[model samples]
Target chain A: MQRVNQTLGRIPPWLIYGIAAFPPVWFFWLGLNGGLGVEPIKELEHRLGELALQVLIATLAIRPLREWTHVNLLKLRRSLGVVTFAYVSLHLLVWLVLDVQILSEIWADIVKRPYITVGMAGFILMIPMVVTSNNLSLRKLGPKKWRRLHRLMYPVCVLAGLHFVMLTKGFQFEPLIYLALILVLLAARVPWNLGRATA
Target chain B: MAGRYKSDLKWSDVTPKADWINRRQLMAGSGALALGSTAGPAVASLGAQKTDWGAGLEPNTVEEITTYNNYYEFGTDKGDPAMHAHALTTEPWSIEIDGLVDQPGSYGLEDILKSVTLEERIYRLRCVERWSMVVPWVGFELADLLAMAGVQPSAKYVAFETALRPDEMPGVSYPIIDWPYKEGLRLDEAMHPLTIMATGLYDEPMPNQNGAPIRLVVPWKYGYKSIKSVVRISLVEEQPPTAWNNYSANEYGFYSNVNPDRDHPRWSQKYERRVGGGLFAKQEPTLFMNGYADEVGSLYAGMDLIENH
Candidate 1:
């Protein structure tokens, strides 16, 4: 585990970002090349949304992974969070500009559709975290307050998972699995107090 | 059977068998040619005819028609059917027409086809998911099949069932929906001229992904109302259980007619994006009864649409 930490520490944060950036670029290339099958726009939107959720999940997993396995990937969490925001923004932009072109209908969709309502709420919650992701803002707010503010990720992740579950037409297991994973990660963070005796 | 109802067709309306068969053969042969091979003469000799039903609408490409499908028995994703439905075995198929029908027995697919003439019908298929497509279907009217089976006067509804072959269908493992998807229509609606049992598309046998062998095509309703891989057609008095409605009665109703005025509880029904329309294409306003109100609107004259929906 210590060796794993040493190796992870040696890998530059830019390399992680570089690797993480490939999916969106590849998906766009697939869109341009007619490789996203028949419903390309729908396919692109689904892929972007899924990637955003996956990145957010990865960002949340970093601390738990370090706590459990002692392989600290703390340096990569901020980059992962920013990438999640980028993907979430692109996913929303696609739906707004390409999928639903009518301005009036867009408002109706966000208002009328429960899944989109929750999704929009999650997206709105994420804006502050994205704004304060940089070093300058992180120092401007003290470390403790900054950490507290970023805890909004918990609700964001839960809402994003719910959005996925509601978007499916029928009872699908894939979205439920995502929701389960998020819940499991969140459960791991609970201070069980059973370890208080040892402390 | 011959004297029951007059066909809404003239002698000249039917395409010549030889030419129709040749066109289908040519299409199949061309596909084989693209793979750097030639189809056998047997496959190259089938008949097919192209019909123009949607006058101003162009049919989606054969690739689009075959690849973009929603056969939940195969899987849920749009591409799932194309990737997984190849495992289905449609040959030697038989359909059981039971319930209130006078003739209640399993009928071989070949025997059923011999009793009817095939026609081309280009239709606009609007999915409840708000995606739409124009497809060229080749088949005979469902009413003809029902007439052959001798529908009993007591029957008020016609229920249809899809095939259940878990060995062939992988999606059945997930229970995403109850197995052997079922659908139903009112007796009059089943007898409507627009409702057909499709056997082929693009002048050839339907690709497996697009419900090979036989499928229902109720163009005026949301595409789910037109169930695929139909294996049974039963005449019943009470409203029969439908797959989607059984899953969620609140979301999917029994009479799922396409209506711009009634929104699906979760999504807008006012507009739909044409499936093959380019990425930036504008959404089109959804038409009541999917633009077939002139033909089918009178069928529900006194009933409240929102209540039935």
Candidate 2:
């Protein structure tokens, strides 16, 4: 137990990669167990939405939790953002495989469902973050350019949360709580220059 | 006495001991149980109670009477009863039946089962929140027990409560939903042929979260109306308050009818994704009254369904 605690005290980047791989592990479990029932595609779609929401929330939570609790989980930040990308990709794959079972139908759903449109936009915006998350890209882009480029996460989180809230037609209290938490976390990170100094 | 109870059972054909033990262990720890087919040996072990009535369902190897469930002490979740109800002292279970009943005393679970001639009924369970299951319930009609108890004409509705034990059901420690879950149906709904005070399922006694001794089942209504782990049954003149309504009045109304046309503000009620149906099975269109309209439709006649719903 002491050894385990000691190991946890060290921040391994592979740990982030391992944590990032869990959505696929869960997807595999769902596939193996026949847990998805008749709606594997639909379940897959919902799973993506949930995973995206979770990753987005985790990404938004990093700065606040770090400042408040002072635990440097910063290594997890980029990886969690990538996991969000992976989940969103899987969500899109299910649509291709089960839903529509055809490309035309997939295109039609993307056009018809406004929620899908917003989700697609969120996924599209995430490509740059995932591309730039690498150490190689960080060196080429430099800290100033990389930080500015990653600012896209804010609108992506907003669109993703809104996509979830809008898709749920009734009063789903759980999603409301998620939205509230994300807003507070995001609000806490407002730029200093944006606020007027009190005289 | 144990031999007499076990007379109908064939131990060899019982559910695999390992599986039953594991399930019992899991169910003992969890307050709710999952819905699935049970093996034969398990059914035989659970089906030992003497009963003159034939099970309404065709007995199958994997079919069992008492399914695992997850109804937390505070409320029912599909998985709750199996996960959180081990500490519930169901052995000394007693139900207080009063108000408009000639017999208004507490009754024990053992006594209640012995008195009723348990029958089997296969019914499609439609949850108000929009999931469904086809269950073979092993118990007499609620009216048979109510008639024996002698309900007065003034008894308009029947209200049921689950015993609230916080120490056993740790979920109650947090206020997610109301404790001591309550459900009600019109007297007519209670006495419907389809409605049952289920004692067993698949062939065994109900697990603790499945409402061990007794629970209500109104097939026409959403699953919530079928209260589990019942501790009280009171016949009232006015429609009493129900659990879901208390939680969200606008979302879950008192008359939570099974209407395919009336969509939940959040989701479509036009169709339902059956809980156990495998992939590629099209979501079956939800029926107006869970396909029990012929039996229960007349009961609500002349009343505005939109208003009540």
Candidate 3:
């Protein structure tokens, strides 16, 4: 565990950001090259949403991973969170500009569709977390309030999972598996009282 | 297969070279006046028919047709059918036509084709998923096939069932929406000229994923209403249990017509992204009955579509 921590600590945060930035770039390249299949916009939107969820899941795992394995990824958590927000925003933008492309229908979809409503809720909740992600806001709000505010991730994850589940045609198991994983992670944080723990 | 027929015969030339040879062999062997007499007028009319239903829209590329599909029995993903459906055994296939039909029995695909004529029908396929495509399907009208089976007056609906082979279809393991996918149409809708039994696409035999061997294509309704890899077709009095309706009664209806006004419970049907139109392509406004209302609208003239849907 000590050796793992030492190795992780040695890696620069910039390197982590560089590695994390690859997916969106690769996905865009694929989009430009006709690699996203027949319905490229749908594929692009789906991929962005999936990446956002994956990054969120990874960000949520950082603390638990440190507690269990003693290999701290605390330094990269903020980067992961920022990347997740970026992907989520891109996902929304694609749906708004490229996919739907109608102002009235977009509003109607977010209001009418249960899945999109949940997804928009998640995105809305993420705004505060993204706004106060830096050290300046962290210092201004203090550690206690910041910790409380950040705990909103739990509900955000649930909403994201629900969005995924409801988007599918029938009772698909894939989205349910993601929801289960999020629930297990959330459960792990409960007994430890890690919500109060500082990064 | 016999030599390829000349191209100058127009789209109405339903007599493929192999069928012509088979007809000659049957005539020489048995002197079957009964079969010839019955088939003569139908063949003659088919030969004279020339219909361009696509209006000027070019058919989607063969790559799109072969790759993108919605055969849920194969899997839920669009690409799943293309990957997994090749495991299906399409040869030696037969369809069981029963219920209110006079001649109710398992009929071989070859025998069925011998009696019917194949025509090129360019159709706009609007999926319930809000994606659309134009496909040039090669087959005959479902009404002709129903007539061949001799539909009774008691038959109010036509129920179609896809073949189930859990061993070959990996999607069946998930129990997505029951084993064999099923769909139904009102007797009038079934008899509509737009409802066809598609055997080939892009002038080629259908790829396994695209419901190879035979499938139904109802242009007026959502694509799911057109069941794939049909193994059984029954003319019944009651509306049969459809797969999607059985899965989610509120979301999927028995009729499932392509109406832009009636949004799906989860998503809007007002607009559809045309497949192969690239990422930045604007979504087209969905036409009522996918633009086939001019021909099929009278079928539901008295019924409230929203209530029926």
Candidate 4:
């Protein structure tokens, strides 16, 4: 675990961002070229959303990994969160521009559809986290306050998971598993967080 | 009970389980979607005379119609049916026709095909998932099928059932839906000329994912109303159960008629994207009865469609 931490230290956190940036481009290229299948817009929209959820899961996993395994990937967490936000934004853009393609349905859906409401709320919550992700904001607000604001990710993650669960037609297990995994990751941190606060 | 619906099926008869998956990967590798049919027979292209139905609308490409499907017996993903359906053995298939019909017995597919005259119907299929497709189907009318069976006066509805081969259909193994997917129509809707039991598209034999052998195609209703891979047709007095309606009674109704004013809780609304319209295709306004209201609107003249939905 120490060796893994050392290796992770040497790998710049920007490298994760750089690598994460490539998929949206690759997926967009696929969308343009018919590689995303017959209904490329829908596939592209779903793929981006799934990627966002997976990246967000990776973000949530970081603290647990450091606590349990003694492998610190603290630097990569912020980068991963930023990447997740970008993918979420892309996912929203695809739905608005390509999939739905109507301006009226945009606000109407968020109002009418519970899943869309949850997803939009999640995306809105991400805005503050993304804004505060920088070192400037970290220093301006100080670590304690900055950390408190960023814990908004907990609700964001929950809402994102709920969004997926609600949108599915049948009782699909995949989205439920994602929601379960997120809850587990969040629950695992509660004891450690309480212990640290008391200490 | 589901075990009763499982046919003697093996992927080995089509292509080795390992090989069929590889075939999809290979097709996916070769540019776009060259998938969906390799596991089944070499599609025989027929040259049936075209009908005036859906005359002005351009039919979507065969690839779009076959590759993007919602045959949940195979899987829920639109492409799932195409990817996994080819393994189904549709040849020598038989459907049990009973319940208030004069001739109540198992009828073979070959015999049914021989009895009915084939016609090309290019119809717009609006799915409950907010996507639409125009398909050119070659098959006979359900009214004809009902006529051949001789419906009794007591029969007020026509209930349909999809072939449930758990060995072949992987989705059937999942508890997502009550197995042996079912659908129904009022006797009048069943007898409507527009309601067809499609055997093929693009003059080719039905692709497995698109409901091979014989499938219902109700142009005026949401695509799910048009059940796939039909194995049973019963003329009953009471309204029979439908797959979506059984899954979620509030969301998916028995009528399931396309109404632009009606909105699904999540997926549907007044708008639908026409597949094969390329990326950034503007969503067209979903039509009432999917633009077949002129012919079939009187059928539901008195009922509240939104309540039914």
Candidate 5:
């Protein structure tokens, strides 16, 4: 356990951020070169959205990974959070600018479509957490208050999963699997918090 | 196996040189009758006549048209049918024409093709998903076949059904939808000169992915309205239950026309992305009745489209 943390601690979060940017860049290049298939805009949008959910799930798994497995990656959690936000933002940009290009219809869709409404809500909820993810903001807010505010991720994760589930045409299994995993992760925190409250 | 398909079959594979070089063999309905097993004058070769409907518009490339399709029996994804449709066997196909028709019997594909005059009818297909494509579909008018069947005066609607081969169609294994996909149109819509039963595209026989052997192409309506790999067509007095409408009556209506005013329950129909348009292409405003309102406007002149939609 000690060796795992010691080895991984030496790696800076900025390096992870640099590594994280590679996928979107590669996907953009593929979209440009016809490598992302005929419908590149849709492919790019789905890839970025799935990447965002994956990273966000990793953020939720960090504490459990350390406590259960003793392999700590707490140092990169904030960077991972930022990475998730970046990919989510890129996903929205592709949908707004490339997939659905009409300027007038943008706001209309965000208001009209149920899946878009849930997805936009999730994206908006991520804003404050990303802004407060910095060390300076952490110091200013203090540990207890910062932790409370960051707990907004629980609902954000749910909305993200729900957005994916609702977007699919039929009862697709893949998106439902994601939603189930997110719910399990969110639900796991409840009993521990309740036990602490009773004690 | 289904990540992305580069399409190993080239343009030559699609447009066989031998088929072109040997016109007599082509006319004789040899092994290379890519346009189904129709013989002689009944065979509708590609680019027969350029009418006003298809004057300025060019059909999408065979690659774009074939690769990106929505054959739900093959699978739900656009690329799925392209990847998995090869398993289907299209030879010795037949359709049962029944219901209120004067002549109700099982007609072999060759017999049906031999009866009708094949010609090119270029039309734009607007999918319910808000993507559009113009295809140079080579087929004959649906009215001609109905005329051969001798539609009874009591008939008010025409219902169509697609072949459901569970051994062949991967999608049928799962309960994703009700099997044996069905669709219907008003008697007038089916009888309209614009509606066609397509046999081929780009002068080649229909690919399995694009509903090989036979299919319906109602240009003004949404793509799903034109059922593919049709096996049973019935003339009935009442409107028939369509697959998508049965799935979600609130979302997918019986009409399923490409009307900009009537928005889908999930998305707006005001705009659509042209399928082959480049990655950065802008969304074009959707047309009313897919820009065929001039020809089909009279069909729905008095009816409430919004209510039907």
Candidate 6:
């Protein structure tokens, strides 16, 4: 059994596509099945939004988690980053398709609603992260510059959380918890050496 | 309680009087019977608050209270009530009227409707959640309904309770609150002419999610002050604990009046977005007494609104 497990674990990293696809696939299934309750479509829109934020945060933590644990999770980061983009695209699609239903209305809502403005800003920032996650693009931008570009995730997460807080009219504990979680993740990244030792 | 007017009150200090009228006379004239529910296609044709109804001193605004809702039981979203209340049983309901009243029994919803002569009142509904709706409610004034019950003067406040059915409302499954949501108003507020017991909107039966059968509509207060799907009304001397107050005492005051000046402990209460009117529509400054200063403002004349809030 131990030898069989080792053999299974040694399989090509791309074979792990199943695990990477699970959250979006499961949430999509939940949205379609009406498991999200009476306003399933709206719930889907919100979940896709939160999931986009979550995947971004998780992707941000990959370096810290790998460094702390001494476990190489290098192969999974690109797929996860792309998945974050996918969820964000879905989130924007829901607003465009279900909510605005018209390009003019979408433009109007984006301008009018503050939360929508912040959410759109976060989506726009994710474009570079999505583009730079590829191997060829990483070589083009260089590793140092690429890492700095991805650090935009910190502000993106904060803005995404702010977008959520603004959307909930009344006091909601869930968004606050997300905000707190992001803060701790950010706090963990405080550089003691300021990259002087690395340089 | 009185010296310099609180910075919030712009005009001279006006006492919020009870403005209580003869509940019995109003009830008798309204032409309702206390037995079976009024059966008809009354609500099938949804009308705006300002439609055709018999005339005599009608409220200037015809906002539909039944259509505008903040019943979070359906969901936290504004649109949840219309979508989630489909599973509710609005028909064959009963309200248990107890505590300090001469008559205490489980009265059928239909009987309550028939017993009172329904009037259409147009009033502004401001939600504590920062939204406003102008609803024209069709129902008898609360004073009219209480008159039929022969209320004893000892009843200083009226406590209202919503039906608690965990099976029907999934939101209640997780202790979002202590079930059978409760709210109360001072005897004076309860007896005020502006306080209504609405049964229908848009010329049709009230939708189940909007608190069908019978619900309180206190336009002067925030939307939550208008309790929905009220199953019980208890007249008591003690200050009753209210639902939002219990959930967060600091955030939701017992009075919950629609005063734009007295901010909720967390957020500013200066402005509200009117629903269906898309964003950027000029926000109307919320009135101190929800625009019922002429009718109910005198009742709280000496009370410090910020302290009460």
Instruction: Give the best candidate by TM-score.
Output: 4
Per-residue alpha-carbon lDDT of candidate 1 for residues A63-181, written as tens digits (9 for 90 to 100)? 88887888798877888888899999999998999888889989999999999999999999999999999899989998988999999999999999999999998789999999999
Give the per-residue lDDT digits (tens) of candidate 2, residues A1-199: 4454345446566777687688767875774455543235456567776877887898788877767766656666777788778888877776566444545545755776677788789889999999898999999999999999998998888888877776652234566777788888788887656565411
Docking class of 2: incorrect
User: For residues B1-309, what per-residue lDDT tens digits would candidate 3 score against the true structure?
Assistant: 111122232343333435543644444222222111122212322231245556656666555665678887778877777767878888989999999999999989999889877777778999999999988777888888888789999999999999989898888888788768899998999987778898876555666788878999999899999888899999999989999999988888999999999999898999998798887888899999999888889988998988788
Poorest lDDT segment (10 consecutive residues) of candidate 3 chain A: A190-199
Can you write out model 4's per-residue Cα lDDT over A1-199, one digit (the tens) per residue?
Answer: 7788888877877788789889999999988877887789989999999999999999999988887788899878888999999999999999988887667788898888899999999999999999988999999999999999999999999999999999888768899999999999998877565547520
| Model 3, runs deviating above 4 Å | A192-199, B1-50
Best by DockQ: 4
Q: Taking the tens digit of each residue's C-alpha lDDT, what string does model 1 give over B1-309?
A: 222223333323334445543643555433323211112234542254444356566666665666678888888988778777878888999999999999999999999989888777778899999999988777888999998899999999999999999999988888888878999999999999889999887556767777778999999999999988889999999999999999998788899999988889888899998876655667899999998898899999999999899
lDDT of 2: 0.67
Candidate 2 local lDDT, residue A181: 80
Q: What is the DockQ for all candidates, taken in turn?
A: 0.59, 0.19, 0.63, 0.64, 0.53, 0.07
For candidate 2, the per-residue lDDT at B60 reads 26
> How close to the true structure is residue A193 of candidate 5, measured as C-alpha lDDT?
62
Distance from true position, residue A14, model 3, in Å? 2.6
Cα lDDT of model 5 by residue, A115-135, tens digit:
999999999999999999999
Superposition error at B25 for model 1 (Å): 17
Task: Identify the superior model by DockQ, candidate 4 or candidate 5.
Answer: 4
Segments of candidate 4 deviating more than 4 angstroms: A192-199, B1-34, B38-43
Query: lDDT tens digits, residues B79-98, model 4?
Result: 78777887799888888999
Tens-place lDDT digits, model 3, residues A1-199: 7777777777876786788788878887877666776678888999999989988999888888887877798877887888889999999998999998999999999999989999999999999999999899999999999989998899999999999998998778989988998998888777566466544
Say which docking band candidate 4 falls in. medium
In model 2, the runs with Cα more than 4 Å from the true position are A1-22, A34-50, A61-82, A89-152, A155-184, A191-199, B1-70, B74-80, B279-281
DockQ-based ranking, best first? 4, 3, 1, 5, 2, 6
Residue pairs clashing in model 4 are none
